[model samples]
Target: MPTLRQQLFRIKPVPRQKEDVETDLKRTIGLFSLTMVGVGSTIGTGIFFILSESVPVAGPAVIWSFVIAGAVAGLAVICYAELAGSVPVSGSSYSYAYATLGELPAMGVAACLLLEYGVAGAAVAVGWSQYVNQLLFNLFGFQIPHALAYAPEEGGIVNLPAILLLAMCCFLLVRGTGESIVVNAIMVCLKIGVLIFFICVGVTGWDSNNFADFAPFGISGVVAGSGLIFFSYVGMDAVATAGDETKNPKKTMPRALIAALIIVTSVYVLVAVAALSAQPWEKFDGQTAGLSAILENIVGSQWPGTVVAAGAVISIFSVTLVSIYGQSRILFTMAGDGMMPKLFREVNPRTLTPVKGTIVVSAVIAVLAGFIPLNFLAEMTSIGTLVAFVVVSLAVIILRVREPNLERGFKVPFYPVLPVVSIIGCFWIISSLQIITIVVFIIWTAFILGLYFIFGRKSSVLGKQLAEAGPTNPESARTDSTGGAK
Candidate 1:
C-alpha cells in the first residue's frame, strides 16, 4: 500500500500543450466577470422559492440563518481559493483532492460533486417551472395544471417545465454555445434588478407585528434553516475554480472570492428582511414563487408580479446552463486524469468543448428533473455540497503539513485557526439535516468508494505506471499521478 504522504505529493504537475486544451476559456476572465458568474449562478431559485420552506423552520429569524450559512460558505471558499490557486486546475475540489490527498479520495469527491452540481441543476429547474407558471397566471390568467408543474410528492404527476428547461440547456451545451461572461453579467444584473424592485415595493407594505415571534422554533430551528438555506451559497466556489482563467490569479482570485461572498450574503439578507417584514412567517409556507407573491401583495395588481416571474424564469434558465457547464467540466477533468471512462475525456474537435460528457450529464439531469420533487432535490444538493466543503477545509491542513514547499499564490489567512473553524462550521450545519439525507449520503459515498477501488484503482494511470516501472521511473510515475502522459 502507498503511504498517504506519497499519494498526496506523488503527482508531478503536467504541462499541457496549449493546443490540446480549449483556448476559448483561456482568455482572462476578469474579477468582475468571475464575480458575476458566482452571483448569477447562486442568487436564483433559492431566494425566490426556498423562503417558503425555510421560514417555517426559522420563522422571521431565517435572516440569521442566511447570515450563518453565508459565513460558513465564505470560510470554505477561502480555503478553496488557496487550493485552486495552488493547483490551477478545472476539476474544482476533485482536482484539488487529487493533488493533496490521493486518487481514491479524488474519485470520491467527484462522485459527491455529481450530486452537488447536477442534481442542483434539476432542483433549480423545478423552481423555474413554478415561476414560469406564476408568470403565465399573472399575465394571461392561464396556468399549467398543477400535475404538470410539480412532482408527485407535491400532489402532481410530473414536472414538465423542469424537464423542458433541462432539455433546452442540454441542446445549448451540445451545440457548444458556451455562456459568455458578458451574458452572465447581464443575467446577474437582471436578477438583482428585479429582486431590488420587489424589495423596495414590498417594504412599503411592511407589518411590524410579523416579527413579534421571530425565533418561533428557537436555536435548533435557526440551525436547521441554515442547513436548508446553505444551498443558496453553493456557487460561491465558482471564484475558486476560475484561478486558471483569472488575470494575475494571486491578487485577483482572493479579492474576487471575498467580494462575491460579501455581495451574495448582503443581497440574501436584504431579500430575507424584505420578505419577512412584508407578511407573517406562517403565510410563507407552501407559497410558490415567494417573491412574485410579495409583488402581487404589494401592487394589488398582476403586472408587477408578472415582471418578477419573467425575471426569475430567465435567470433560472441561465443558472441551469452555468451549473450544467460546471458539472461537465469537472467530469472532463477527472476523465482526463484517467479516473473515469475515456469517452468523457473527448473534447469536440470543432468547438473545443467536452461534447460527449456534457450530453451524458445532461441526459441524467433531464431524467432527474422529470421525476424528482424539488424539495428533496434541494436537500440532497445541500448535503453533498456541505460534505465537499468539509473535505476542502480538511485538505488545506493536510497539504500544508505534507508538502510545505508547494507554491501557492493565495493562502487562507489565520492559517490553522481559519480551517479548523471552517470544518466545525460545516459539521454543525450538516448535522442539522434530516436523518434520511444523512443515510442516503452515506450509502452514496460507500457505493462510489467501492467503484473506485474496483475500477479506478486498478485502471488508474498512476497505479498502472507504478506496477510497470518498479522504483526507477519516478518521472513516469509522477506524470501518471498527475493524469497525463510523461
Candidate 2:
C-alpha cells in the first residue's frame, strides 16, 4: 500500500521537456478566433435562458445580480490568465492545480471542472431545445411532441432534440477546430446582434412602475440572484483551455480573456436591464423564451419575437459546441498525463484534434442533456464552477510562492490580496446556494477523489517519469522516456 503522503500528491511540472508527452496539437488559433471561442461559449444558455428564472428571485434587483456575477467572474479570470500565461498548458485549472498544488488536488480540480463544463454543456443543449422548439413553433405554427423535446421531469419522455444537438456538435468537432470556431465566431456575432436588438426594442417599453419594488426579496435576493446568474459566466476559463492550440500563449491568452470578459459582461448586463424594463418583473416568472416573449408582448406582433427566437435557435447550437469543445480538451490533457485512457490523447494525424476524446465526451453529455432535469443541471453547474474558480485562485497563490521566477506575461495586478479576494468571493456565492446543490456537489467530488486514490495515483505518467529520473534534469529524462524521438 502507498503511504498517505504518496497517495495524496503528484505534481506535474511544465512538460515541454518531455518529447514523448508533447501533445503535438497544431497551434493554429489566433487571438480573434480564440476570443470568439470565449465569447461563443460564455454568451450561451445563461443569458439566453437564465434571465426569466432569475427575475422572480431578484425582481429588478436582477440587474445587480448580473453585475455581481460578472464581477466575480472577472476576478477569477485574472487568476486564470496569470496561470495560463505563465504555464501555457492545455488542461485549464486542472493543469494549473497540478502545476501548483500537486496531482491529488489536480484531480479534484479536474473533477470540479469536469462537472462545470459537462453540466454547463448539457444545460446549454437543454436550453437549445427550448429555442429550437420555439423557432419551429413560430414559423410553422406546429411544435414537436413534448415527449420528444423534454426530460421526464419536464413532462417529456426524453429530450431527444437536445441529444440530437449534442451529436451534431460532436460531428463538427471531429471534423476540426478551425472550422468549428469560425462558425462559432459568426454565431457569436449573430447572437450579440440579436441581443442588441432586444435592448433596442425593450427600452421603449420601460415603465417606472416596474422599479417600485425592485428589491422585493431584499439584499438576500441580490446575493441569491448572483449565485444563479453566475452560471452565465461559466465559459470564460475555456480560453485558457486553448493554451496549447493558441498562437503565442503569453500574449494571446490574456488578451482573449480580458476581451471576452468585457464583451460577455457588457452584453449580459444590457440584456438583463432591457428585459426587466420591457415587462413587469413578476411576469418574468414563467416566460419561456423570455427575451423573445418580452419583444412579442411589447410589439403586440409575433414577427419580432420570431426573429429573436430564430437567432437563438441558430446561435445556441454554437454555444453548445464551444462549451463541449472545452470539456474535451481538458480530458485530452488528462489522458496525456496518463490519468485517463491513452486513446483519448491520440490527436488525429489528419485533423490534429482529439477525435476519440470528443466522441466520448459528447456521448456522456448527450445522456445528461437528454434525461436530467435542466434546473438540477444549472444549480450543479454553478456550484461546481464556484469550486473550480476557488481552486484556480488558490493555484495562483501556490504557483507564485513555489516558483516566484516563473515567466509570466500577465501577473495579476494586486497579487496575493486579489487572489484571496477571488477565493473569498467564490465561497460567499457558494454559501447562498440551496442545500440540494451543495449536497449533490459534495457527493460528486467525493466520488471523484475516491476514484483518484484507488487508481489515478499509480498511473500518472509524470509521477512515473519523475520516479525513474531521481534528481536528474528533465532533458535527460526526456531522452530516456522517448529514446530521443522527435
Candidate 3:
C-alpha cells in the first residue's frame, strides 16, 4: 500500500492533447481588463459594509488593519504570481496545487476556494441588497419592507433584492465572457466615480476629534480588525489567475498583480481615512451604506446620500457577477482534473461556459441569500480565504525546494522571508476571528477531508493513471497536443 505522503505527492501525468485544454480559455482579457475585474470585485461590498463591523472592534485602528491586510495580500500575490506563471492553467490554486502538491491537497484547496469564492459571492450579494434598499429609500422617500430586505433572525422572510441581483448575475455569466468583461469595466468606473465623490465631499466635513479615540482597544484590536477586513483584499488573486489568458504572462502577470494590489490598497486606505475623519468610529457600527451615511453628514441633504446609494447598488451587482464568474471557473478546472464530478466540467457548446456548475452554484447561493444573514456569511468567507492564502504561501516554499530547476516566470522578491511573513500574518488574522468561526472552519475542513478520502482518493484520475502506468514510465505518460503535460 502506498504511504499517505506518497499518495499526497503523486503527480498525475499531463493529459494527452494538452493543446485542447490550453486553448479552452479565450486569450482576450488583457492587463487593463484584468485590473478592472480585480478592482470591481474587490472594492464594493466590503468597503461599503464591513467598515461598520470592523470599526467597532478596532476604533480608528481599523486603518492599520487595512495596511496589514494589504501587506499580507501583497505577499500572497507575489507567491501566486510565480505559481500562476509556471502552471498557466485555469484551475487557479487548485491546478497549481495538483501539479506540485498532488491530488488530495488539491481537492482540499478546492473546498477552501469554494468557500472563498462562492460563499463570498453570496455574502456580497446580500450586502448589495442593503445598499439598493438604502438607495430606494433615499431617492423616492420609500423603503422596501424590512421583511423583504433582511434574512431571517433579522426579522425578514427573505432578501428579495439580494436574490434578484444574484439571479441577474447568473444570467449575465451564461451569456458569454465578452459581455461579462464589458459589464465589469462599466461597473468598475461607476464605483470609482462614486468613491471619488465621497472622498471629495467627505474631506470637507472632516473633524479631527474623531481621531481622538484612535486605538481605543489597543494593538490587539487592530490585528482583529485586520482579520475582518482581509476579505476586502480577496479579489487581488483574480489577477494572478489570468495567467493562461495573458500575453507574455511572465512579464504581464507581475505587472498586473502588483498594480492591482497597489490600486486596491490605496483606495481602501483613502476610504478609511475619509470615513474616520467624517465621524467617530463608534458611530460606524450598524451604519448601513457607510459612504452614503458620510455623504448625508457632509451635505446636510438627502440628495448626496441618494447619489452614493445608486452608485453602490450598481457597483455591488457587478462585484457579485465577477465573484460568481471566478467561482464557476474554479469549479470547472477541478472538474476537468477529475477531482470533482464530470458534470461540473461540462461546457455548453453554445456558450462555451460551465452551465451546470454555474446553475448549481447559483442555486446554493440563492438559498443562502434567502436564509442566512450576511454577517455570519462574511466571517465564514474570511476564514476560508485566510486558510487558502496560507496554503498557497506554504505551497510556494514547497515548490521552490522541490522543483528548484523549474523555470519560473515570476519569483517572490524576498524569497522565504516574504512567504513566511505571509503565513504568519494569515494565521494572526485567522486567530482574531470569533471562536465560532474557528469551530465552523474546523468542521468544514473535516467534512472536506472526509469527502476527499472517501471519493477523491479512490476515484482520482491521477491515482488510477499512476497505478496503471507506474511512476517511472515516461513512455506511459500522457501528452497533450502541445507536447505539454496537463
Candidate 4:
C-alpha cells in the first residue's frame, strides 16, 4: 500500500475509461457557440458599471487598465488552451492540477473555482436585479419595490428579481446545453449591438478635455484600476470549462478562447474610450449604470439610456445563465471524480444534462443572490479567478517539464516565460486588492481545505482507483503516479 503522502499526491491518469466517459455530457458545443458563451459571460454588467469603479483611480488612463487586464487574461487563457488541448476534461483548472500538480492541489484549485463560478453567479444575478428594475421602469413606468429587489444590506427584504433570474436560468440549463448556447448567442449579439450604439452616439459629443488628465495617478493608478477592472475578464475560462462538451476541444477551445478575448477586449476598450471622450473621468465617480448614463448625458435624451437599459436586462440574464451553467458542470466534473456527491454527476436521460446538479447549484446561488449583498462579490471573484489563473500557468509549466512528449493542439507562445509572466501579472493585480478581500479569500480557502481533509481525502475516486490497481498491476499503478505521462 502507498503511504499517506504518496496517496495525497497521486495523479489521475490522462486516459479515461470508456464506461467512465461515454454516457456523461454530450459534445454539442462548437467553436462559435463556445465563443458566444465566453463573450456572453464576460461582457455582462461589468461594462455597465465598471467605469464607476475604475475611472476615479486611473482617470482617463483607465483605458490602459482594460488593456493590462486583458493582457493578463489572454496570457492565462493561452496557458489554459494548452492544458485544455492536452487534458480535454471538464473541470477546468481543477482537472489540470489533478493531472499535473496532485490531488491536494486539484482540490485547492476547486476551492478557487467554487468562488469563481458559484459565488459569481449569485453576484452577477444581484447586479442583474438593478438593470431589470431599470428596464421595467423605463418601459412601463413601474418597478419592483426596493423591499423585493434588494438584499438586506441594501435596505431591502430580499432580492426577488435575482432569485427569479436564477430560476429562469436554471430552467434553461436543465433543458440542455444546445438550447442554452443558442439563447446566450442571441443575447451576446444584442448586447454587442447596444454597446456599438452607445459608442456611435457618445463619440458625437467628444470633448478633448477628458484626455488632458490622463494618467493623473500614473502607472500605479493604471495598475490599481486594472485590478478593479479584472472582474470583467473572469468569464473567459468558462470556455475551457466546456471542454468535455466541446466538439474537437483541442481546436475549438483555443479558437473560441482567443476569439472571445479579442471581441471582449475590443468592446471594453472602445466603450471605455467613448465614454471617457464624451465626459470627464471625474464624473464617473459614484455613477450608477455608467454606460447608460453616459449615453443619456451625450445625447441629452432618455431614449438612448432606455435602449441600453433594455439591452443590459437581456444581456445580464445570459451572464447569469452561463455562470450557473459553468458552476453545474464543474460540480458535475468533481462528482465524476468522486470529490462531490454522485447526485451532481447524475445525468438526466431526457436531456443528457446534469439536471440535479443544475437545480442544486441554482438553489444555493439563489439563496445567496436573494439574501446576500454583493458589494464585495466582484473583488472576491477577481481574487478567486486570479488565483486559479496562477495555477493554470503553473500547470502549463509543470506539464511541459514532465510531459515533454505529450501532444498538445495549442501551446503557449514563448514557452515557460509567458507562463511565468502570466503568474507574475496575476500576483501583481492580486497585491492591489484590499487587505480585507485577501483575508476573506484566505479564510474561505482554509474552510474548503478543511472539508477536503475531513471528507474528500477519504472518499477520493482517484485514490481508490490507484489502491485497487495496486503494485501487482505495475502498468496501471505507474499510470496513476504524479507527473506520469502516458
Per TM-score, the best of the predicted structures is 4
Per-candidate TM-score against the hidden true structure: 0.89, 0.93, 0.91, 0.96
Candidate 2 local lDDT, 210-276, one digit each (tens)? 8889899999899888988887887788898887788888778888998999999898888888888
lDDT of 3 at 42: 79
Worst 10 residues of 4 by lDDT: 477-486
Report the C-alpha displacement of residue 68, candidate 3, in angstroms.
1.4
Tell me the alpha-carbon RMSD of every candidate: 3.4, 2.9, 2.9, 2.6
Q: Per model, state how many residue pairs clash.
A: 0, 1, 6, 0
Off by over 4 Å in 4: 16-23, 472-474, 477-486
For model 2, the superposed segments whose C-alpha errors exceed 4 Å read: 1-4, 15-22, 212-217, 471-486
Pick by TM-score: 2 or 4, better one: 4
Clashing pairs in 3: 14-486, 16-479, 17-480, 17-481, 18-480, 18-481
Question: Rank by TM-score, descending?
Answer: 4, 2, 3, 1
- State how far residue 189 of model 4 sits from its true place (Å): 1.0
Can you tell me which runs of candidate 3 are displaced by over 4 Å?
A: 1-5, 12-21, 212-217, 241-248, 474-486
Candidate 2 has which clashing residue pairs, if any? 10-103
TM-score of 2: 0.93
Q: What local lDDT score does residue 153 receive in model 2, on the 0 to 100 scale? A: 91
Residues 126-158 of candidate 4: C-alpha lDDT, one tens digit per residue: 988888888888889999999999889989999
